[model samples]
Target: MNRIPLRAQALGARLAYALPRPLRRAIAGRPIRIDGQELALDAQLLITLQRLSGAGMVNETPEASRRKLEASERLVSGPPIEPVTVRGLVLGGVPARLYEPAGVGDDAPLLVFYHGGGWVVGSLDSHDNPCRFIAVNAHVKVLSVDYRLAPEHPFPAAVDDAVSAFRHAVAQAADLGVNPDLIAVGGDSAGGNLAAVVSHQQVLAGGPVPAFQLLFYPGTDGTTRRRSRDLFADGFFLTSDQMDWFMDHYMPEQDRRSDPRFSVLLAEDLSGMPPAYVATAGFDPLRDEGEAFADRLAASGVPVVKSRQADLIHGYINFLGVGTRFREALSEATGALRTGLALSGRKGADLNT
Candidate 1:
């Protein structure tokens, strides 16, 4: 549990945002311009503060890292979105949370969401706020999948759980008060990778597939390094060292990283996958690969809304508590989710409409 009281943290966040832009900019230092895109002031301030704290996920044991993130997020993410009922449930034996906002109908759309932590550290609690935000804002139920992590479970465990949970959600949609045809698969970072793999698995199996996919700065290709990986490799919250730590723990074998199960971007056939909204952060290390995945999807004739959040960084999805940029970026994705669900089953419908 978080050490600081949620109320105090929320208050502090409010006060931080209440500061004038000039002062905040000065305190955060000069604007970070990389690859021709400037970082948002809020993001820069947050990064600056994080650097000043001298604490980071790098070099920490997974257990300690998890605890630190859980505590730190409470101080920044404000409070969880409210009036959205959360309940525990099991989908295909995977523990999950169902976030259903008040006033939603029985046949509401459901996003089977995977929490991002590089396939290692995050949990349902770590991602509770994002799920709640999506549920309320998208006007849909969010099935936040608590899949097994890596280092202990590793590789295909998270992928298996993701696919199973999504399949079960579709199969049991009515019992879960959702529409089967409107079910989407989504996640951030590692979670996004799982969602993309699940979409491919379902389609390849010639069976049920996700109606849509919501990917946030997803790790699309793990085998090859891209320019963004080097450009934003350091000081952007998710650093190269941390990423190496995650990969080393999650998939120790470097050769296997290119497997389509882990690297969805390398999949031979991507056609027939569901419509997707892939959001990449301009300053994120995974930015180029995520955009590459979206480009592949589009080239394969899949309807894709590839959005580059030019001022944000990786993990912005979880920073919804204090900043406007994060919220603004997420709002666009959630709105697209709502619209995607509405247009899901129409055979020839324009998804980008």
Candidate 2:
């Protein structure tokens, strides 16, 4: 809503990215090393810019946070990619967007994607760029769900919408030009949490399970505080204060933190869930929990790949529009999704287990 401030921030980002690494590092201040990992120069520079511009996720009200996220999206999201056509649609009465990359045939794999904002700030516009990137790069169709946010639709509202949208995608896959058997569920941060929960619920329901999962720095467990939560609690873009703010709005009742829908990591069984590629950012507070979830998936005989972008910070997926590292990291993710879906297709509907 406030273009002037966001314009200044975008200019700052462009200048920072243009500078040589040495100069960028100089401006970003001394190397920040914590938890045995050195901060990537790109991440450090963005953090510095954020601090200087006073732009962050935390705000006095959820409405303000939502507006800020929309504006800030332009600052970090790179120029839009072409050849990906997006169409508005409704899934099980929930608003959604379908991204179809050029050249992908009917029966292409589809990914049900949820946007991150700790379940409070992100929206269809805020995450449109990344969804396009994934569709174009992975050669897969993407259904980006605009799930209801919290403090307005708290607790299980988002969880319920996510499951419903995913089910609708499966039921209408043929009409939507996708292969139902090759569908995957994915998202970043809170969206990732929903994707993980969807996989669990589908499996437990005993049919029409997602064939794969692409989780990017997902918050898997809200019930336990891990070391990373304290270590990178500040200065890493996604601050501890912001996390608390999100949890307060989304799952206000502290007693419900252990619900499997909120904290999939605490679920009784990880068995029979879809194969997955779990990505974690080194400096993220949710790092440990995400990796722990991946470990459990592996232990339960689910095929899983845990990737730690050792120098990046949280929310890198949205940064793909600005920096090289962000694009590279996300490219790796899309490539994995491409490969995973291709493999899942080969295995046929048996993957629906």
Candidate 3:
């Protein structure tokens, strides 16, 4: 197999090792203190921070982080894409981007995406490439949502916006030029959490349920501590410390931590949900919970497919041309969408052509 160059790999490892001992310890050992409260860090967050701190220091501000993302996008080659506008506003407001690929029809299936940033970061621009690739590869229109973030708008706000955006899509299906009945919801990390919650909310509200759910290393359980926390807590891009920071800024109130919308793993039931495509990174601390959620969904009779990228790390989906792994990940995800939309009975002329 062709591997990332040894020199690059070595450099990456060294950076991981160079993080301050205390910062590394905080990420790897002990619970994270957030707003004077001890919030136990999950494996995924721990690993994410370790990697971020190791490879490059964490961006202290949202703007700096966005710049890094913008710079990375300069590397990938995406297909012809166009944006669509979504109407009907809700709590977090209505902001959407529709990516139309080459040779796709007006009645194409749609993939609605939520960008990840621990509920506090990430936006439409931050995840543009991934959405474009999905639209092009799956031959479907991709609608990406820009939901409100936190410490400004906490729990239930993001969830509310996601559901609203989804409902707007369903209600204005013809206007958006797609088969409204054949929509899928997908996101990474916190965005994944939003997708799952929105799916549940839509089903409960008797709205159109998405045909498929694509979650990449989702934060399924915010309350339950898992073994992966201790095992992969350090040296990953997302750290337990950063997770605590995010949660504190995003949730704040401890009482709301167990709400199923915030922690889907704690939801009372998982039956009758749409088929799912869950992707997990081997080095991701969120790995276990994401897989566990898929297992639960499968056991509940949801047609679920789980892929664990053994050599890749968290946030690989947004890395674009940094490594071939991101492209491979996008292809697999879009393939799942193709099969998913087909099963849902939506047919675009180019779906399989």
Best by TM-score: 2
- Clash counts for the predictions, in order: 0, 1, 21
Query: 1-353 in candidate 3: lDDT tens per residue?
Result: 01444345434533544567566455456644422333223333334433443333236765565554443333232322444332422322587877777787888888888999888877787777788777878888888898988867787888888898888888788877888778899999999988999888877777678878988889998887777665567566666766777788788887789998898878888887888999987766788889999999998888999988765567777655332445777688889889888877734435756
Give Cα-based local distance difference scores for all models: 0.88, 0.91, 0.72
lDDT of 1 by residue, 51-70 (tens): 65443555378888887777
Q: After superposition, how far is residue 337 of candidate 1 from its true place, in Å?
A: 0.7
- Candidate 2 lDDT over 239-302, as tens digits, reads 8889999999999899989999999999999899999999999999999999999999999999
Question: Clash pairs of candidate 1?
Answer: none
- Ten-residue segment with the worst summed lDDT in candidate 3? 34-43
Model 3 vs truth, CA RMSD: 9.3
Flag regions of model 3 displaced more than 4 Å.
Answer: 1-58, 61-92, 346-353
> Which prediction has the highest lDDT against the true structure?
2
Q: Over 4 Å off in model 1, which ranges?
A: 1-10, 345-353
